[model samples]
Target chain A: MTCKEVTRLISESLDRELPFYQRLSLHAHFHLCIFCKRYARQLLFIRETLRSLSQRIEDPVFSLPPLSEEARESMKRRIREQVLPPDQGNLEQ
Target chain B: MNRKQPIDQHQTSHPEVWVDQHGDYLFRYALLRLQNAELAQDLVQDTFLAALRARHSFTGQSSERTWLVGILKHKIIDYLRRSWRECPVDEIDSSLNSIEEFFDKTGHLRDISHGWTADPGTILEQREFQGILERCLAELPFRTATAFSLREMDGLPAEEICKILGISSGNLHVLLYRARTHLRHCLEIHWFVKIRKD
Candidate 1:
């Protein structure tokens, strides 16, 4: 396979999303091509790095502070007013 | 002062029930995609508000959670498009320096088949790697970034992403291709050139 083909398949290969024949072709190319091998390694590294980074940032303390009770109530009130018309002011039916 | 009622219990068949239940999760999901808490919160709120207005269109084929997420995904794309139009394309640092330096200086790549061990301790301590990945994501074109974030971060299926983005599967693949290629190149430059210099 050409470098362009290898490049296009790198992400799919890393994700294991490519079809069997495509995977075999990529494996064949990588086995013979040092550049493609390095490229595959780099792609793998990128995937690994992103996966780890996502895990680290997965649970950041909600950078914005929690909505205050007043703010929450105000938002609820606004939503209620918008959804419930004047005649249906009492949302509970 | 009157006690505040729970948002979920609010009686109208409004979509707020969905938000009340899933808002925080949606916010977290959007924050991961947008990397801006305020924007994430707004996106979640907009998702619910829009869903409420168009509640009729929901056919109930999928779970409500999935439907809301689908809506939120579109909101994210719209937000990205608006923001992209507002801002000029500028070069941002997209280096793989930290990972490269660690590999070159310490040769850890040989020891670990995966550059990162699955251990939580090692992963959390790699702050530079996290920063680089975030920077790399930011460098992606707006649509490509949205598609990758939806697929990778949100774990949405390709078909769902196509429906939400109103793009063909071929278009979706193209966007995903661009996103992944840009990320790979960014990582390579970070490792090969940036880290070697350091």
Candidate 2:
């Protein structure tokens, strides 16, 4: 494959979406081509690094703060106010 | 542990309860992708509001966590659509060229795979890396950045991305290719080269 063909296929190859024959052809080209090899390495590095970054972002500590009792009650009250009409306050009795 | 049971049961029983319980997780998830705290907070709020409004649609095919995340995903896409406009196709080539120059000047095209580490535990703990990533993300055109973040950071599939962005598969591939290429160059410049120097 020419450099242009290999270049065009780099994204698909990294995505693992290329057919087996296409993958083989790309691999063979990458082995013979210094630029394509560098491209593959860079792509791999970027993918791994971004994946790691995302995992850290999902850490439990980074999640929302736990609801304190006051906050929880406030949220409940807000929900009730939205769901209940003002005239219904006396109907519960 | 027993004291937590009622809370768990309440969350399981009502979607609103679940949102109150997991709003922070959803916010952080959106924030990482949006890279804007205010937008992320809004997306989380919209997600919960939509979930509460559509609770009857819940079919139990997935766990509550997955259900909440699904709603959040849609909310994010909606937010992206409203806030992000496409760059003219004419601008793509110039942006791509600039990115190439950025990489070249930073000497990131050189090899340092021997010293490169793939561990997120180490990489994310560093403030410099985070700052670099934020800068890199800022350099991207809005739509490309959003698409890339949704696919990579949010783990959404390309097909879903296409549906969300209303683009053809080919267009989505192109957008993703451009985004990834830019990010790869930036990461090399900001992280890899700096690490070698250190």
Candidate 3:
């Protein structure tokens, strides 16, 4: 397989299982091809970066603006209305 | 001989505390997926309300955040489905075509001769690297980003992603391929290549 074809296969390999013959040739190409090998490694790295980032503990550094105070108050109010008795005023714990 | 303190089920399940506990996290999850603050906020609000109504079904199997996120995920998919018809499939195709510039007529790579200098572990630790990655992800077509995020970020399977994105399995593969190619290219231009120069 050519470099272009092998690289596409490498990308697809991440998402799905490839046929054995295709996988065999892809590895064979990787043996002789430094460029496609680097390509595959870099793509794998990108995938890892995203996966880990998703699982990482919420860091303020990765900040998207949090819910505003007003929004929070309103959301709490709405939730309280549903859970608390209708006549029960705001209860603080 | 000590007795465990009796905790009120109502107190444990109260949705107001949920607002304080999971609200920001859920908001950020929705914001990343939807990219609209108002809509994200609304979805988080809706998720809490939905959770409250469904409180009795809380099996305690998953963490509270996970359960809430599951609810938000459905909401996000519903929003995407509503907008799916307007998604420009041709635009996504043109973007993939741009990636072909990396290859020659003989199907050989043009200029990616050297490996990246920074190690993946080190790069993953850098906050700035993530910032650049988020920017690259934002550059992708909406549906392409949705497929990539569901698969890569959320660790969802392609079959599941296809269902959520309302695409076929083959189309999901194409979207994933496009996502990886575009993100790699974008990072090369914006981050990796720049690091090489410096």
Candidate 4:
């Protein structure tokens, strides 16, 4: 297999299981080509960084800003309007 | 009844309280995936509304935050499905053109020496690394970014992503390939090269 096809396979392998023959070719190419091997390593590293960043995206420690107060108020108001009796929703205002 | 009714029917499932407790986290989650503040806010609100309607079915198998995030995830995917359908075909085709540029006539990669010397631990800890990563993601087209986020960041399976993006599994694979290739190339130039120089 060409290096280009092998590299695309490498990326696809990360997301799904590769067929046995395709896997054989990929490993063969990796054995013969150091560049494709290093490219695989680098792509996996990128995936790892992304996974870590995903965790931090959820964690408040990463410094991602929260929803604005106005957005919060609007959301709450909209939720209240759905759950509350119409007359009651207006009463809170 | 002349008196207004309290919004919270049950203490644990109070929708308004969800807004206070889980609102920002959900917002950031959606914002990172959707890459739109207003749309993220809209999806968060949609999640709360959906949760309020489906509150009766939420059997407390998980924390309220987990339940809310689950709902918000669906909302985001549904939005992506709609928007992706509306995307012009040329946009997707043009994105594919750039992926080909990564290779030369012999089908070997153009940059054989692309180096990523930093260890994963060191890279993850640096605030600057995170900034560069986001910048790279933002450079991708909407479809590719959404596909990558759903697969890598959100950890959705290939089948589910295909369903959400309304594409076949083959198309999904190509989209993900493009995402990984573009992101790696961008970070190599912007982050890894700069670090090596320093």
Against the native chain B, each candidate's TM-score is 0.51, 0.70, 0.81, 0.87
lDDT of 2 by residue, A45-93 (tens): 6666677677665565333233344544554555555544522443443
List, residue by residue over B1-198, the lDDT tens digit for candidate 1. Answer: 125442433233454455466666666667768877667777777777777666657776787777887888788877765664564434111322222332334322222222322343353355565566667777775666777877776556888777766667776776676676667666555543555456
* Full candidate order by DockQ, most accurate first: 4, 3, 2, 1
- Which structure among the candidates has the greatest lDDT? 4
Residues B60-116 of candidate 4: C-alpha lDDT, one tens digit per residue: 778888888889988988888888889886786564447778899999888665556
Misplaced by over 4 Å in model 2 are A1-5, A19-21, A60-80, A86-93, B1-20, B56-63, B82-115
- Native-to-model Cα distance after best TM-score fit, residue B114 in candidate 4, in Å: 4.7
Chain A alone, model 2, TM-score? 0.55
Q: Over 4 Å off in model 3, which ranges? A: A84-93, B1-11, B86-88, B94-97, B111-113, B117-122
Give the TM-score between model 3's chain B and the true chain B: 0.81
Which wins on TM-score, candidate 2 or candidate 4?
4
Question: What DockQ does candidate 1 score?
Answer: 0.24
Top candidate (TM-score): 4
* Model 1 chain A weakest 10-residue run by lDDT: A61-70
Summed over model 2, clashes come to: 1
The lDDT of model 2 is 0.64
Alpha-carbon runs more than 4 Å astray in model 4: A86-93, B1-13, B95-97, B119-122
Better of 1 and 2 by DockQ: 2
Model 3 has fnat of: 0.69
What is candidate 4's TM-score against the reference? 0.88
Q: Count the backbone clashes (under 3 Å) in each candidate.
A: 3, 1, 0, 0
Candidate 3: give the clashing pairs.
none
